[model samples]
Target: MRNGNRRGKPVEKARHFWPTTKRLISYLRPWKWGVLLSILMAIVSVALNIVSPKILGQATTDIYDGILKGVQQMKLGLHITKYPIDFNHVGQICLIVVALYILSGLFSFGQQVLMTWISQKVVYNLRQDFKEKMGRLPIKYYDQHSNGDLMSRMVNDMDNISGTLQ
Candidate 1:
């Protein structure tokens, strides 16, 4: 049906979603390792992103405490011999937060690349299988189905499948 409409025809619903889903998943069997690795990378990236904010908060707290201490010393009218702020500690915390963010970004990028590669490979294999099946089909099948519908299934549907996989 074009645009989800079949004129006077009734709509068809999926009667076995789980079985269909399992079949789709079978296509990913060859690249299971890649899928697992991509999932791991995504988890690590999210964890790093989550932890960085807390680390940065520690630095903010340090700065605030240092400023408060300096203000107190000023009120006491004592000669401030040393700076209240421990710049070294704050600097180290900032560096750690920066490193974490960079690592998170790297992991995220790696996940995207791996997933895209896996999805494209799956789509390529599927297209090859479809071509082979089409070649074996009887000529009568072609006469019954429109060329546009066949091409739509061959190209657009495969592209949609690839997108869904990614």
Candidate 2:
């Protein structure tokens, strides 16, 4: 009564249809915050801190070429009252530039803190949900599978998720 050229046994088909992945994805709701935080941190780290330095450097170059050079030219002219500008005021301007560099570093530090918070929170919630779901599944199910396989899914998969977040 079975099909005409069946290659494998019915039991083999049953063995291949494991339900681990579908079961796991159902419990991933609470970890969204961590995922969002990770994306935010990555974007901020790349865009703000990295890109800002190049932009600031260009701005500094413009100031040096246009304003600083103009001041030098004006100082050399006899009509100083008409084009009054000081070249000896580099001390205060240098301090301001240093402060901007410090501020950029602070932005990077803040992003790291946010990323760590998200990664830890997501991994903790994911582990907790995984354990809870595993506990609820019937014991008869475990009888069909190896303990090592079950443990690998519970521990190793979660560790992989956390490592990936990093």
Candidate 3:
């Protein structure tokens, strides 16, 4: 059957999602601080990106005002001379925009790095637990199961999980 949910679990399997979600949450609980900080950084980055257009508009407004001021002075019979470019203010705005974008990029990169670390830490814990569980299982259990199938399931499933998280 075609999948309904994005995760591809059928209605029957949907019943398992909550418990699985709870288990995953338990695994992630240890890295709550990293998760929180990453979210904060993401929010700040988005906010900066959103504000950039308005700041750019303000820059054009400032240039327009400068031009109008220069024209008025020319009409008043002063030297028909200097272009009214405020290099200092324009330079400051350019620096501010550049800094904001740079900071946003830094924060986004930091968040990705932190998230990767957290996911790896969680995967490490899960693998350790799986190893311990395997050690505790009886030889009879191993005899009942295909060793190659078990190994493939564990390794492939874990890899899929790690890929999804990262």
Candidate 4:
């Protein structure tokens, strides 16, 4: 029985990757708008995250430049008339960077929620289809295959697919 089970195991390799992917993507047709919006949110979130670091770098550069200017004035024996560092400008930059990060986080959260909702819907539809198909199979088919294996495929495999989609 063990040797027979080993021989009956499903193949691991995909015979047609692109076609399979296209077929899988077909399931997302009903939620196409949600998918598109989720993708856009992901793009915007990544862009904001990428830009925040450069904005921070600007604040660092400004501080370094101000310190160098102050040191040069001291070397020349000039009286200090004002503070070298521009605190207001640095503060504004900090605020902008913080805002960008917040926006990025919000977008990321929204994308995650949208994706979870979409994946659940897809899985729900798939389960319905599976149930309907199983009902249509002949009695002889049930007699040929192990009932435990069929149940595992119907339940456990679906759960695995749901996790992958998410």
Q: Which window of ten consecutive residues has the lowest lDDT sum in model 4?
A: 1-10
> Model 1: which residue pairs collide?
none
TM-score of each: 0.85, 0.50, 0.73, 0.85
Q: In model 2, which range of ten residues has the least summed lDDT?
A: 78-87
Residue 150 shift from truth in candidate 4, angstroms: 2.4
- After best superposition, candidate 4 residue 149: deviation in angstroms? 1.8
Tens-place lDDT per residue, model 2, 87-144, is: 3444455555566566656656765676566656767887777789889989988899
- Which residue segments of model 1 deviate by more than 4 Å? 1-15, 79-83
| Clash number by candidate, in order | 0, 0, 0, 0
lDDT (tens digit, per residue) of candidate 4 on 1-166: 4434567875566579799679668888999999999999999999999999999999999899998898899889987876499888999999999999999999999999998899899888888888899899999999999988998877886787677766
| C-alpha lDDT (0 to 100) for residue 88 of candidate 2 | 42
Could you tell me the TM-score of candidate 3?
A: 0.73
lDDT of 3 by residue, 1-166 (tens): 4755567766445457789779977998998988899889889888888887677677777899888999999889888567687878877788888888888898888878888888898888989988999999999999999989988988886787677776
Over the full model, what C-alpha lDDT does candidate 1 score relative to the true structure?
0.90
Cα RMSD of all models vs. native, in order, equals 4.1, 10.6, 4.2, 5.0
Question: What is the per-residue lDDT of model 1 for residues 1-166, given as tens digits with 9 covering 90 to 100?
Answer: 6536558566667689899789779999999999999999999999999999999999899889998888899889976876588889999999999999999999999999999999999999988998899999999999999978898867987888889878
Best candidate according to lDDT: 1
Each candidate: what lDDT?
Answer: 0.90, 0.61, 0.83, 0.88
The positional error of residue 16 in candidate 3, measured at the CA in angstroms, is 1.2
